[model samples]
Target: MTHPDDDDELIQELALAGQGIALVKMEGRVFLRFEGVVDEAGLHVPYALVPAQGVLAKPSKWRKLEREARAALIAERANERARRELDEHVRAFVRELAEECEDAGLAPMDFLHTLADLQTSEPAGAIFDRIRQRLGHAVERQREEQHAERTRQSINLAEYPASFDVARRLPRRFIALLGPTNSGKTHKAMEALAKAASGVYLAPLRLLALENYERLLEVERHGKPLAVSLVTGEERRLAEGATHVASTVEMLDTRTAVDVAVIDEIQMLADRDRGAAWTAAVCGAPARTVYLVGAPEARRAIEALAERLECPLEVHVLKRKGPLAMEPGPVRKVKNLRPGDALIAFSRRDVLMWRDMVAEMGHSVATVYGNLSPEVRRAQAQRFRDGSADIVVGTDAIAMGLNMPIQRIVMTASIKFNGVEEEEIPAALARQIAGRAGRYGIHEEGLVAGYDADTHEVMRSLLKEKPVPLNTSGFAVAPTLEHLHRIAAVTGETALAKLLKRFIHNIDVPDGFFYPRITEDQNERAEWLDTLPLTVAEKFTLSLVPVTTRVASLQSAWEHWAMSLAKKKVTRLRTDDYVLHHMTLQEVEDICRLYSAYAWLGYRLPEYFPDVTLAQDMSREASSRVDSMLQDQNASARRRRPRR
Candidate 1:
């Protein structure tokens, strides 16, 4: 066969001959165009041609060139086919390897780079064999780690004593008051506590505690005044020779024995963030007779707990004293509103707007919400109760244990954005808010109204349905100093927050119980505390600070107070010069929270935070000012409205 280089040389020779070339063929069939130069005449010119037969011979250069081209085409096609097959095989192997790694809980990404390199190199089969061997070891290691985790969880659960074990030491009798809202469950429980010679009242909210404390102080025992003390996170008021105490659930003084103990809002045992306190109080309160007051939904769980404790249990199912019915249509505007009407709003801005709107309609208005201090909420409730305010605009904070003689409840919206998402009010919550409408002796019937058609329908449906029963409760294993030390030693972690997280992860809860996870805010605060120069125990204590971290100013104040406390310095608070008139409601609320945090720390470390009395007075003043401001704003709005 003629080489390609020879064909190139022949083409060059033909180009230099000056004859016009028509076509060139590998088989030597060439066509040539020829012309002769003449004076106004054309002449015949000789044309050179290459015969096809001569070139077609076996030793011809044209035949060799054709043969070489055919061989190269075949080789290229075969190479392409081989490369496709190799890619297909590698892809199949990778898929199988990925599945195996995932099934064993091993990360396939760790070996992805190595697998990619092997795919492009020769002798890939050997590398794949080595990868398979390593994968087997990885699977074994993963299994071992899972087993260790399970074992650790079991050990953690076994370290703590169950409620039954703790209750076995005491001769306690339990009485549960199960009913829906407006059922007078809390009232009955309070009556029992009042009759007892020495007792305690545990309320879910500080407002409720304060209410009961004042009630007890006014009660006459054997023609003499009863001595009652108030204990909450923010303030404490001790009466001389006091044998009865009213306290928030977190301040239940579980170490002291009492004749009777009343725990209100027992249904809150299902709350994710604060349920642990309720559980602890129920399981550990040192009382001869305990009264559990809440909705009927908590009956099953409380029964189970009572059975476990081997206590004498009696259940009283209370019925509502007055009728509760939903209004037929929506209440559109302030013109349709009336005296003794409470408008419920989800946000502070909404509450303020509604209050102003109602006041412009010539009705006096008071406000209540979660951000307001306990004292503020109480003062607002008092105004509504005393008929000093013609109407009240509030939030779900009223639904918990506040006693207001509201004849009707008008919900502004059926849905509220609960921090994470917008959700319709649950049946239980709806019932609680609606139940606030009618007072037993005051209003013969309670009416629930909605602002819109959708809200009206939701309210009607919720009032008709029963609350879902509580099937599970959350519990956490209490971490002792020993437990913390052990977890740090095992996990090689020096940070208290990290150690607490690890310990919680390894705790084994019962079948119907779960461990509450730390909230995002809590985790953020804990991370910030981890940077301080404090011991692990101190950091852990600071992480558990009861101050609300959602407010930026309050969080900053708390961190500074905590740092001072950690340094063992007597922190002096400047509250005398706090100008409540110049501050917004939110700022006043933040200051109230700061005061509460200081008081809470004082209860734990009195030497470090000795300004509890001052903090309490400042908090009370801040709360009173907020209430007064709302009232003043309402009067101003009423005056500004155009006269008819």
Candidate 2:
């Protein structure tokens, strides 16, 4: 004899009462057990069911069930907080990888034949790393194999200059300026550019392009005033009588031959994604004289480029005007940070955290990271340059395009996130960043140090280690529309993705001089775009839009644009009018990138996306808003905590 509502059916029915009911079992009989069984009105108090062991005392599994229930409750109570955190972090780790694995049609985790504890003695990070190995290896390996198969079929050509239209532009003079930091190499190149009546300066970043554009505008060539214009994906400031242009490397004008051209960061020929641009610039820049400026390690590659172009190359190597040295010891703590120091951290989160900490320590902070718009970065850098801000906190964005007078560089870590795992940084990149300190005329010498003892040692060793020289052969090349279209006409294959794959797999390239490669992002985008109802040229153009696949907002916007293009609808540029007070800095940066992509697409497909001018205006306004927000936020932080 047990409680009336002790059956499974009644138990489930009680579950619908909007509260929990405890159920108990004994031998083959069931019992209802609930704690303080009462409604808000106390209506069940008199008729509440109660259990008494004496009422149905029989041989039962109470001894076992009670033991398990008590043990489970007690066990959960011990180290419960630690266990809960561990469980949560593990779940998050697996969840992140699981999403990536979803495309591979595999689960990110696996089951075992035996029972295992929910907790582990190993470090959480190590365990996560171990799990990472299991989930993505197959998919990643498969991708590698696919790429390898395509590359295996790559043809070798001793002489093929189809990448650029430089056949008639040969016999050009090439001046290669190679040096360490503070060597005035850029100044030398710029001076030459200013002396030329018609010239182009190709910069690695738009910020540099804009900077050099302004520098050139204030100059007169042979007492004749020179009209300068700025051209970048974000903006194009063309003057009425422009005789010279400063543009990003990607925007290099191959058709228009200038009197002189300066290609900054020529070592970027080894860059996987944009190397083709440098190759094209080198091969197609129809200039009488060209300047190649980069590290001395790029000498071999530069020589190869000159040989291929059949240009007379004159090399100049300059020593640093000021000295650079490793710090004797670590900075150890934030309290030891000094003025004129550029604090380096790899991730945007770390940069922001360091900025706040430095702010609280009474130094007004200027921030720079990869996500900040070039305009915003320039403003933040200006504060540091003008001595309004004590120090700057940044990532590798500081490694290039900055003109700050940093006397020292204090690295907070020796590792950086490469969109994946944190790994030791390469010597060349570390030196490039460390070289930012000790600008000529700013300080006698530049110092580099790490925050802690271990990282300090790593950075010191890295600085001493020689930078790896690039290969003398096999510069990266990408296909032009002409190359792709010729293949289309030959094979009658109008699918852009197939054409791209065929180009990479079947194109003839020199064995070790120039090879073809399409970035994985572009290939992926091409595959996705091929599914849409669009022409081959349209798909190819959309594939090259400057959008990162990892960003959901960017990917969604890109897809929407492609859809609009396929529907033959006019997609006008749209934004929040730069009033992004509610959005975060990263969000604002992403909006800027979106506008940039739109501007790029508009320039390519003006008939469909005709708001390039509007997009440029909005991007500038957005950048200004971001800069204002950074400055005001720093001031607010100072107000909250005055300098000690």
CA lDDT of every candidate:
0.73, 0.76
lDDT of 2: 0.76
Range of the 10 consecutive residues with the lowest summed lDDT in candidate 1:
36-45
Give the range where candidate 2 is weakest over 10 consecutive residues by summed lDDT: 111-120
Clashing pairs in 2: 157-509, 474-512
- Write down the lDDT that model 1 would get: 0.73
TM-scores for all candidates?
0.75, 0.74
Please provide, for model 2 over 1-644, each residue's C-alpha lDDT reduced to its tens digit, 9 standing for 90 to 100. Answer: 33333334444543523322334444454333222222212122211122222122122533334533433432333233533454455445545655666667754444110002223223345545655665557776666555444433443334445444553444588999998767899999999999887889999998899899989988976676679999887678899889899999988887777889999998888886888888878877778899999988899888987887678999999888888998899999888999999999988888888888888788899999988878889989999999999999999899888889999899999887765688999888888899999988869999999899998999989988877787888777787776677667655677788888877876666465778789888888888998899988899889889878788999999999999999999999656544677888778888888888899899899999999989888888878878887887777766677535
* Backbone clashes, candidate 1: 2
Q: Which candidate number maximizes lDDT?
A: 2
RMSD (Cα, Å) for all candidates, in order, is: 16.2, 18.6
